[model samples]
Target chain A: MQGVNLKLDEIRKAVIEMDDVKTAQLVNTALKQGLAPQDILNNCLIPGMKEVGELFTRKEYYVPEVLLASEAFYAGFNIVSPLIKSQSTEKKTKVIIGVVKGDIHDIGKNIVKVLIEASGYDIMDLGKDVSTERFIKAVTIEKPAVLAMSSLMTTTLVHMEEVIKELIKKKMRRNIKVIVGGAPVNEEFANRIGADGYAEDAMQAVKLIKKITIG
Target chain B: MNILTIKKHGTFKVKKSTKLIDCLAKNGIPIIATCGGKGRCGSCRVRIITPQKPPAERETLFIPQSALKQGYRLACQHKITHDMTIDIPRLKKVKFTRLNANYGLALDIGTTVIKGAAVNLKTGSAEKISSVYNLQNSIGGDVLTRVGASIDGKYDILSKLLYSSLKQLKNCLGIQKPAITIIVGNPVMLSFYLHEPVNGFAQYPFTSNLNKGIFLKNPPRYVFPIIGGFVGGDTISGILQSRMHKSGKNSLYIDLGTNGEVVLIRGKNIYAASTAAGPAFEGIGVTCGSLALPGAIDRVSYAKGALRFHTIDNKTPIGLCASGLIDLLSILLERSILKDNGRLKYAVPISSRICISQNDIRKLQLAIGAIHSGIKILLHHAKTAPKNIDEVVITGEFGSRLDVNALVKIGLIPKGTKKVSFNKDLPLQGAVMAIKNNNIFHQVETIREHSIHIDLAAQPNFQEVFVASLKLAPWN
Candidate 1:
């Protein structure tokens, strides 16, 4: 495949115009060449997903736009993922995300998952109503880089510490970077529970994960 | 002389009854009889063992013949003539105390106010209810302001303020301790109550860690399930107490407060969501708009092109009530004093007969538009329309007295929908129910499970409709 100069304007057009086919085609063309997956991801996928996240956060785009952009991002991710050398998997990190037990809310968790995954990270989504033991077991088995716990209830948030404590009990606390998010879990609460970091949003989660790993 | 006995459940003793109505009335019984106990409600019927004179017209008209044959006599009509035994059926003696008792602790955690009541459960009523402005008002008056406050190190203040308010309410009610505490509030309020972070509700996948149930080791040992934020505990309480869930027809329960929560119950399912209608209905931002309290103008009537209003105190003119605000908007629109698009017809020579202003129309438009847009989203999510709606049960202070016709004419509530109404204290009723039976927690969970929560933020057309609705001036 001959190299195509994937300029900023071209990538921005793919995102702003919401042309999934064009975005995927350009990313695939770049990947098929000697261009790095990391470059394509940072220049195209991250920025495109960031636009979707920002538009959603600012109330500019609604659910349909966000959903469509995420799908488009997924199309681009599929193209770049295979070309990334198997050794590059070590460069990326695994993160486990779930809504706490007794909380069946997943919309926020799902959005965060989408944004995080689009950021070139592997996610272990435990889904909603995830018990502390399940989180502990996942921590022990997969040993993900970051354990992202989410909850929508003020009442169910107390369960986050239990999961954190269980991780410590299993001697997996230092090995795992625990990130807590959701409507009720604040930075202070995260600090109180001894979590590694607290991301206010999905985009923030990506930044925090990047800082913890790449730094 | 006839003897009648009033007993609890199964056991009773014979007592001389000279005049049953007088005795029952003196005893503070609430018997439903419109004709002053002339047996209109058949609510005062009692069984008699001794044969008496033929049934009276009042008795025959209201009470069934079968019941009459089974010794049914109107308590008001029955008088002692000879020594006779009277059987007081469970229906007659179903003592209903003032609904204050059951709530024992009624907490109305409004964005601006936190009012509560400590009721007696045994009497199926409310008792010493207390109300106070929420201390969180100091941090911010609205949910967004509060959210901002939460984001900026003011979360503790909200928690402490509400806790202090609840404590004070308990003290005022002389409640030693509320056995089962039920909190009914907006999502923000609920989040603040449990000290959960609420900033997430302001963004995507909006929700908070709302406890489905709590088994507290504290004084109020049993913690009930929280309804949900946005369409939080208050609306959940409204649905439970109003029995809107049980209604056979397609119904909508709109609790118009700072956060207007709309619930559409059809068959076995509930479609619930909330629109940030702001504090317009509660008179927070509206000039001359006040709550449905004493001296507030709650109703408006137009006669001969003149707009007249009826106040809560039945006194001289006060500020406009929530309903009156909507009516005023509707009247302005109808008389061509305001445009259908919610603009004032300033060119027309308007006299003292009626007054309409541009600002008034804008205020009305915002309030009514929020409500209208909310209904549209709810209906759309439910895959139904206003025509499919069999009834609209309007709750809350603003909802109770809303002019249904005006609501339709101004396109607030849809037309042809039968408007069912309830007083502003339905949340109190629900709190009472929750405190009385632990089962209410499970009931709320079931209701929550059956409910389809539609996030207005997620609705693509919400902003478009909201902006479109804002064009209409003060919702008359």
Candidate 2:
């Protein structure tokens, strides 16, 4: 308990208050005190993000506030992620997310990425306007457990299907679970496109990813 | 039938029945046709170098008198009757109707149109209101396209075109020199008016600098603080007029132009976001789309498999404006002629000559989807649901006469919008207010500083919420 002298409660409080400087300092201090990386993430950082997400849902925390908190969470995450490894002796559930081609809007994709990544998953963000071949390449290389895609414009929603078809054509579909969400995407479209699941918001997205990882 | 040669392009043969745009496009000639060959857009303009018959009434309505005298005609309306050589008018000409008064100008610069109202600064009463087409249309129709043109070094041309047009519009006030001028529009228009670099607007994390008290360097000119990224001075002006910031309860303000801006006021906090709602509501992209001018259809209803429409001036139906488009979609939904997925049961004719296409419905879907998502996101941010809002004040050309039921039917606005107030010229009114009382103008920064600029594009759940909005059925 003395080796865990680092007060995670203070770190959680800093994340809730959206204080990046304090969180970065606390995370660093906690690591120097020999607290396990897994405990630092699962107890201190993930809980902080989980609280931030809940505050977001309650409307107590808004986009800017959530953004600030995420900034703090990442400040800590940058330090803790490498050492954490999967606590269950299994590989970390890796996920990839991107906005579809022709639609460079990343507001939605960023939210899903932050929330899922904060919930203790390894996230590989492909960024916006990702091409089908690029997605095919990333999936083949990373072999992520889940592939999430977003499209804000109706014109670009078709790219999601294109990415999926490319995955199937490359015989990568069975290896990765595909989930789609965006302003123009729905569960019906997800079902029709043969995606594993669809989530409407960042909080819901994290929950969906957790469910998939657990399964 | 007649043969005509476009200046640079090759000669083409055409019949009187052939639309000039279609003829030119079919022959692989370059021309602007954002409105899908609709004469209302006035984009596909051509000048007949050879003498020809006078322009039709529709053509005269949009074309400047000087252009008409120069034998200018809209390609969408001008059909070939006899052999004539034509030239695409690259010149930007402006017409001014001088007013006889010493006053101030209040302006609302939309992406598609510019409206200027001269106020007797002493009494703070509007002397006259004059409007004209934005000259930037020749380069591009939407803000992004115009931004592209500006990024491509067309800033001077765009700025000069606007300056001359404003100069002409000022002539309508008939004042030799106005005491003051206040301009308001989306971020791009305000930036274009002053010839500022719009590079910030071209990418993510879009920034509009007007909020920091930086404005046009020219004297007797002022712009409202940029409220948030795409939501510009005009939106701040709307907030000023609505006085939503002073409210004890929750309220919503929407400026529903081509770029729909939404503001949620909860207690002392303000949240703003802009959605690219497309040009459908403004009558720029639809096949039979036109501005909210006389003879333009503003309302529509379906009865016994027939479409009944009401025009702006009780004249023959020219084209559908914003409100009429909303009504038409609702009627189609009610009659089951249009499915929730934006598919047409079949091609339905609105009038003897005008018909609705499946593509138009899809365009409307994308537009409505943008607005619906914006409202939801803002409300969510404010922690105030639609039902908690005290009032929804809509301010804009397209939003003024919009039917609440139609909007609800299409899931554009919340179903609980029982007391929606339409103030189409909120920016103009706010300008008048600022002129009458300098006290409110001082609070513009306080507003910009206090309110949060939410980048909805960054929201992780946006795709999920936006996808659900594609459905045309009423919101739950």
Candidate 3:
């Protein structure tokens, strides 16, 4: 327990350096020593991702780096997830992400999912060609912090409204924050459909989520 | 009596002597009057249970003389007379590739935007797309400007820009080398890519070596031949993918890009024409018009004589682009904010949002007029009318975003037309096909040969139609 701070530093270096095996080891050791899961997430994982996100925003990193870092983050997460659940510690946040219905496009949505998960949030990855009902169901079941919807086609962008309509029908829209992204999507489109937020890029999604949840 | 009412959908007027085609065209009703509304195509024919005038020369030329005697008339050829009813069967809608096997790459070389995509051959679907400003953008924003640049002997820079762009796209896709690549672009894009002089498209004889596909050593792929300078390979690819050839049903495929390409298919006969739609649809040349890029207000409201705009970025006020231009123009027409002369009602005190100037209206008039003239030429040659046009297939990513009702209101698309919107990432789709399917690669050869090329400038009536269509009310 006295070595908690030392383990946290090692966890930070492992995530920053994108060393998944070492990061996972440090995270497991810290959790075994009775360090708070939230502290490890906020102080180590969050800071590490913030640096990675900055690299992405500045174009220092691309889709590959973000994806690899996410893999490392998940490796560490698998070990702590069982402990936190057993101890009944409150989870940070859960999220549902998908490319909207009729839009089978996925590169953009996949990028955003990796970034969000790397930020210490649990993700329900709905994948592409997502139905509105499925989104609503996932939101109700997971009670995620945000619903991130992506669409690359203008013709299919209308389906985003269907997601919201389904949410209103289920009376669960008020309980979840909805953020939309994609090439054709813009803030106007987001506002038009009454989404809580709109991110033009994967990095922007991270920053906006922080603003929304932390605020 | 109910039939006599005409049940006009939007703002079309029917007259006793109004030729069915002219009436439909005037109302902005979408009639795929490819063949320039000529009866020669039989595409403009409508069943007239209602007594109507005898067939015109163009209709008689296409439909058998005996069939014409039986009371069938080209909608462009005959006019409605009595108050009786008639049946206008819906034309078969053009279907695009939906399956992954059909997906292919598409490279759209627009006057303003250079778009690229990766398509699937098995289903003819598209993905892995990217778009950026045509680096030749620095040369000029419109084809005419670029043509002028070519005329000035600065075509090399334009060609270099395009070549590098393709290279950049290839690199981005991680395609070290694709075995086969399909390219769809306007005549300018193709010509520039080939490093050929573009002056032919600017004047008559309007012919180029582009009717046949070409091979480039640099890209090392088979480049699809453009049907014409204006129409380009994108529309050709679209026409081919639409299967307009298979149904033997008279169909017209119009790809409204910087240059508008219109094709007419009647039975096995195919005729293609080009219209200098310019960059009007992209919002260039219009006073307040711009491309549908960021900061452009795509929709505006002038309810109760006040203005509100919804921009693309949802940010602070920005200039209007093509999507916004159509939206604003339609809203203005609906509210009578502009006079019939295409002049803004000056008395209303133009809103700050309406940056549209007197000059901009003239440009819109010219651009719209060019589109109208192209349709008329197709009708004139095909001997068809607007009403006879069964289906109007307008392709383009921009076309999907534009409100059909608004487009017709502003005389962009014909009125009362049933428009089927296809996700037009054609250049990318064509590329994807080129990469995977060897059969499609061969098909491109046949498409080049079978594609009937109509020189818009050489067509005798182009000047007259272009002039006539230039007016605010082209119908009269």
Candidate 4:
């Protein structure tokens, strides 16, 4: 048990250090030592990512560092995720995400997508510059529990409201919790656009989605 | 009844509750409101010479308390409640007589700065060279930001700002509406100047409305033709100045500024790509970054385990400009104070107010990554290696001030290139050349006909290449 605890600590440290190769090697070693994949994931990888999120919020880590840490987290995650017994897919809540039309800045959206996936949620990424019709089509088809919209430019911020209006017009607003984010987005603007939630960063985004979905 | 009087300019009859900015514009006063009179940019600041109105909530955010105390207020935030007199600072008129009838004005509208040259059409020699900050910068510091602003229905405001800047440049050069004017800039800037919608640049399959040379009747101005996507008239101007299109040797031309446009010439093929390097190279987004002006640190050296630096005019160090940022990064990497992954070990203070932070290094890394990856991808598309390139031409605002060794040390330019040269204001030079010889337009059209634009974002391996290039190390 003590040896298992030490191995989990090493995996967490490797993630913080953004050492993808060391992380994959350590995860493989733990798996060969007869450790449960779920236990390794719950105890080591998620917690490592949680710390990374905290560091990002504190400004100690930036986009490049966060991206690298996410890479390291996935390096271990890919080796362990398939080995875990499949959960009931029906119980999982799906989130549809996209950058609004006229805005191609997706680095923030990509980060949020990774963090939310790491937290074990279903994500439907609609890439960038997605039109309003496409968002309505996805919401109508996917019937997602949450719709996440991002725009890095002030000009494109109006598209988020347009999506919300279209959702209301299609009578899909109540079925999905709409959340908006990006550099130009604020809680006031989100409220004005009738979005259910707003997140300042990726960590807040994941947490906001979790809270809105579970409630 | 209310009367609004400008100190030097004429007074105007105004109604109560009219926005000061709108009143000024209606009265033919050229005031810069980069945020379109939204009380955001503070560019339209005026000094109240009459009864001082308390600063508005937005004014407090942008104006310093001392300035406010001295009767300065944002024009957008002020309304004509009563009779008022104010002073506008930037409307000072310069006194200069027209020198000659055969003079031509050449203008390069950059995202950050607008440069102009007064040329003797007969001799093709520049009579005067001057530059001013692009007033649209107060809307946003980058091309995309301004494009977004234009998309948000601020096109008229942006166009007005461009004209005001041009008017200022004309005044500085002492040329009052030369017989013929030549304009060269990026696609977005040219579009803004023509009041054309920039919605095409807001998304993919980036189409430009100004792909051919246009002549305006009222102003007698000739706007240069753009290539494609973000590779606008400036790159065409650069090619014209370098004559790389006609050369047999493989040559790379890079215009490094807010937008890093790379053009590779091999045989008859001309390939170009525009990388959105942001304003990091211009020192807009960094913590202690500034434009290359007096008091701006433009060079740095590490010797005897200490860092030494020099400003543009041997003045107090205000902040790091592009060249200084590159030199400082090279010195930091040499001392291992900054990691290859762009993490700074600690903040290195150049002065009491200015320091190189970890965030600054990351900004530089992103910028360098964009340019380096752009060059690599262009080379990959051309089926040529960096070593095979015969000449590399670097041009932009930094020009001769940039240290070639430091740029190479920081891995911005490819390692072991055959020859490297720096040309100052190639776009301006090309515009002047066009004015001197009207037949150059035919050559420009030929070059445009042979050019191909590659969308860097659309490339499959762009993310991987960009990430790999982010390391502050020499090319392999």
Candidate 5:
């Protein structure tokens, strides 16, 4: 408590190490000491995940490691989310992602979400096997900056375009930047299906969304 | 209406504009359609000796222009219009174990292929073996894709197709019905045989009613116990075959088939995980891959800048089979043609007819990554590393033939692998084991309760490990 700045460093270190138990314990300790939630999130959880992503890109850490670190990030995020709501409110970038209707493969999508959240994005994960109506409804309600869809089967890849057309029918296509990816999807397929961008992997998903959002 | 005729095979009458995939499936010979004949994978290709119309646009995109010119077209994409001659080229190879008693059948129902061995109960040895491409593949090459195929009410047809394929395998042994039939497969394949719902596996917390084996009337059949949704009865059989629970040394048994299943043992504790390796090892999704048949390249070697290879039966190299695919990847790695990140310096031609594409390398990477990550996770959960393991047992018809060096170079096997063993058809072997001793069936139930099943998909670090393992080099 005396060294609040140093304690924040320790929290970041725990997240990087993917010590979820330690992360939860430290978050409670920092809050009991009356540390600011926003500061903790910005200085601890976010930086911790950023380092996890960097380690991942450098080939030092793999999916299992990042997944554990993401859990650690969430452990801190769960504690700080409610507390930060009462403090200063800053606008967060909103995104919606799900495996399209009839496809439940979400391993790649989940990784993309974790990496994106680490990069400081508010992700509304619709989860896998999401219905087109649910996707349309989420777009209308969440009005996210991007709507990402994924599928592992080539048969279900058509549903991604179906959602795109449904978006156009409901006048939501222009409102959201659509991105699609999975095993069977390629840039040409993305272009053919009217997606704004296509990401090949989890790391690319984050970069693709940032390019689309910033541009 | 038109008639489709094969020069030497036979003649089949077809409806006007009906899909060639459906036409073939209806005639009891479904060709390779990994994407369920949607014309997406371009696997169900056939030679059109006579054509009435031009090829589809996607055909040009998928097939080489020369092949397209020579009348090679995706059967799924080509529709029957006029009477034409077509050729479906594939070699049929089946092993005859040895014949003794009245027929007893043991089946290993794989996602991509269904292999059955006729057992002679009197001698406790396999009599004759026959395998067929699992017709459920028209549904998909993987369980999840098959789940998607079931959405269109084709699940019943899938079951029926499987029944017919099983009969065909049985008939090859000149047996009408085995006195007893024991079927073993992963959850998805077994569930299809059991007529369980496939859609349940595609949703959250993915559940399946595939737990425990069930007996059927009339035929005296037994479906093996499924440990978990994805773990299936196949892993249970692997455990029984390897006797991992009783082994003093830490042992790892891996079945490198369509859906890669891994089992780890540390004393009395057993851990299992299934990773969707995407049929890469079975030679399903690769560019020039074929099942191990006559004329299919099964091995490759390069020394002093000389490239040489051998076929399955020492025949001419028509296509690369499973072992050849792995060896090809290994040779490319050894020669620096393939980079650690799974990119090729350029397209490498293995033959005038067979060229290794960059896409093929990526597919292998994904397959290896899936399997390698699953192994790493199961080992991690056991709180152990690869070095601590005393034995590595690879089970599968394909894995049995793999060069140990290829696995080590590709990083599929741990660098510290000390005792490596080959288990040909581990699930089938277990099924045969259970058939010989019905008491072992009870042991499977015990095996299920004692082991821990890890859903690699749900594992937190699966993605990280998978991505890291995507490197085409050995793990340091």
Candidate 6:
């Protein structure tokens, strides 16, 4: 048990160091040593990513470092995820997200998707430059608990409001929570656009989703 | 109560308290008011022969205290309270007869700078080259910002700013009128120049209105055709300049600027894409950043544990230009002062006023990553590896003074390319070629017809590739 704990700590350190190959190797070694995949994921990978998120928030880690750390996180997650059995039979909460129409910058959205998925949510990524009609269609079909939209440019952030107005027109506003995030988006802009919540970054986005949906 | 006299021109009666810039323009003496007489750009500066009014608060922003003390003031800020004789330094006495008959003008209207060349039509060579800051910079720093500004009903102001800058370029070149004028720029700039709506560029499925060679009758100017989306006539101009389409060797042509455009030639097929690399490469959005000008650090080298630097014109270093920034990054990486993930271990001070901060590295990383991913995606679409590329032609003002090895070391340029060369002004050269030879218009059409524009943002794997590319390390 002590040896397995040391291995899990090494796995976490490998991720923070952004060593994808070493992270994967350590995960494989721990699994071969009869460590449960669920224990490894709960004790190692998530905590590693959490530290990465904190480092990014503190500005010690930039986009490249965060991206690399995310890659390392995935390198270990991919090894242990398929082996872990689902403990809960309940249906997971669904979240639909996209970059607003006319804004193709999706890096922030991609990061949010990664963090949200790691946090155990079903994500239906609508992809970038998503139109208003498409967002409405996804909401009506996917019936997600939350609809998140992002835009990197000020010119395209208006599309977030357009999507919300269309949702209200279709009477889907009351059924789902609307969230907005991006470089140009702020609390006031989100409120002005009638979004239910605003998140400054991916970590905050995940927390916001959890608060609005589960609570 | 007041009279205004412009040296080398006739005196004009002026009303008291009227703005000197407005008064000068009213008297038919054109002053280059780049800020639209807002007293911002300082282009409308005049040297007063008589005792001038004390310098206004805004005048001190542009004019040195020594120059201000010597009776120089901003015309836009000055109100004519008394008779004044002033000299407009920018307006040159034009020799119209010498240049009117055989001279042709080529203008490359870029987002940051406007480059002009006076082509001797008979000789088919550029005689003089002049450049001016694109006055549209006052409206917005980048194309998308300007597009947003245009959407908000600042279209006329944008257009007027461009025209005023063009007039300034013409005056600088001392060309009264040319036999022919050819203009080339990115699609949005051309659209703005033609007074077309920029709505298409503001959204997905980006479309351009001007895709063919257009001739305007009033000024007898020919505007080059655009390819698609952000890949505009400037890329076509670069193609014409490089003759890449006719080359048998596989070649890549990249114009690095605020908008990085990459064109790949593989056998008979041509692929082009535009990447938004942001304004960092143009020395915007970074602390201690400036355009490639005198007093800008343009080169840096590390030897024997000492950092050596050179400024443009051998002047005191004020800030880092694109080339100097890349070189500094490479040195920092080599010395381990900067990590491959673009983390600056410490702020390295080059001068008392200039220090490279952590945020600067991040900005450059994004800019370089955008261009790197663009080149990679184009190569992948063409099914050609970087090693398969025979020649790479880099164009733009930033590329002119760039160290090719530093570019590769910093991973902005792929490492395995066979040959790399830089052309300082390909767009201007292409415009000159069009002016000298009418046959080039047919070639432009052929190139346009054969070219395929791939929207980088719409690519399915763009995010994945872009994330991988963000590393400040070399990759194949």
Q: Compose the digit string of candidate 5's lDDT tens values, residues B1-476.
A: 78889655579888999987778877767567776665667777788888547788978766778888889898878888789888876525443333445868888887767777788877768867777877666555556666766776778888888888776677667666678889888787887788888777664455788677788877888888887757888888877888776677899888887668888888777888877787666666676776666788888888778768788777777778778888989999888888776767887888777888777777778888888888888888999988898888888756227888788889887887888888777788888887778788788877887778887766665556777777667763
RMSD of each: 22.6, 15.9, 25.6, 4.3, 8.5, 7.7
Clashes of each: 33, 13, 60, 0, 9, 0
Predicted candidate 4 versus true structure: per-residue lDDT over B1-476, tens digit per residue: 69998888878899899888778765556665544465545557789989877898888866657778998998878989999999987554644545655789998998767898899887888888887767675565566667777777777877887888788788888888687888899999999888788888776778888878898987688998888988999899989999898888999999888679999999888999998886677665576776676888888887887789888878898778888898899888888887777777899998777888776787788889889999999999999998999999998756126777777878898888888888878888999888888898898888888888998877877766877777778883
lDDT for each residue of candidate 3 in A158-208, tens digit (9 for 90 to 100): 678888888888888778888988865778679989999999788899878
At residue B297, what lDDT does model 1 achieve?
71
State residue B279's C-alpha deviation in candidate 5, in Å.
1.7
Residue-wise C-alpha lDDT for candidate 1, range B1-476, written one tens digit per residue:
23444544232222455566555443333332222342323445567777687888867865556778897887777766655555555232212223333345667687655677666767645766666655454443456555755666767765776677566556666665565666777777777777778877654456677746555557563334555556777777888888878777789888777577888887887888776665667654444556666767777778986667777768554456688777777777788877675546562222222233454455556667778777877777778878888777777676236776777778777767755564677776787777777677777877777888887655656555565554443221
DockQ of each: 0.01, 0.03, 0.00, 0.39, 0.13, 0.43
User: CAPRI band of model 1?
Assistant: incorrect
The reply for model 3, stretches above 4 Å from the true place, is A1-215, B1-105, B119-125, B142-156, B171-174, B195-203, B215-220, B301-305, B347-354, B397-400, B471-476
The local lDDT score (0 to 100) that residue A148 gets in candidate 2 is: 93
**Residue pairs in candidate 5 whose N, alpha carbon or C atoms collide under 3 angstroms:** A62-B464, A62-B465, A63-B461, A63-B463, A63-B464, A63-B465, A64-B461, B97-B127, B98-B127
Could you tell me how far off, in angstroms, the CA of residue A44 lies in candidate 2 after the best superposition? 48
Categorize the docking of model 6.
acceptable
Q: Which digits, one per residue and each the tens of the lDDT, describe model 2 over residues A1-215? A: 64454488888878878899999999888878878878888898899899889876654454555777888998888887766554457667899999887667876677778989898788999998788888888988998999999886544566788888888887888888888887556776798888888987788888888787665
In terms of lDDT, model 3 sits at 0.64
The better-scoring model by TM-score among 2 and 6 is 6
lDDT of 2 by residue, B247-366 (tens): 666888887777788888888888998887767776766666766767788888778767888988798986788888889999989888887756677767878756777656766787
Return the clash pairs for model 4, or none. Answer: none
Model 4 CA deviation exceeding 4 Å by range: A28-35, A56-65, A83-90, A102-105, A153-155, A184-188, B1-97, B138-140, B149-152, B216-219
List the global CA lDDT of all models: 0.67, 0.76, 0.64, 0.82, 0.79, 0.83
Tens digits of lDDT, candidate 6, B1-476: 68788899978898999988767655546555433455545556689999866888988866657778888887778899999899877554543223554788999998767888888989989998888767676554467766777787888877888888788788877686888899999998899888888878777778877878898886689998888989999999998899889988899998878788989999888899998887676666666566677788988899887888888888888688888898999999989999887888889998877888887788788899999999999999999899888999998656236787788889988887788888878888999989879788899888888889999988989878987788888777
Model 2 earns a TM-score of 0.62
Q: Worst lDDT window (10 residues) for model 2 chain B?
A: B89-98
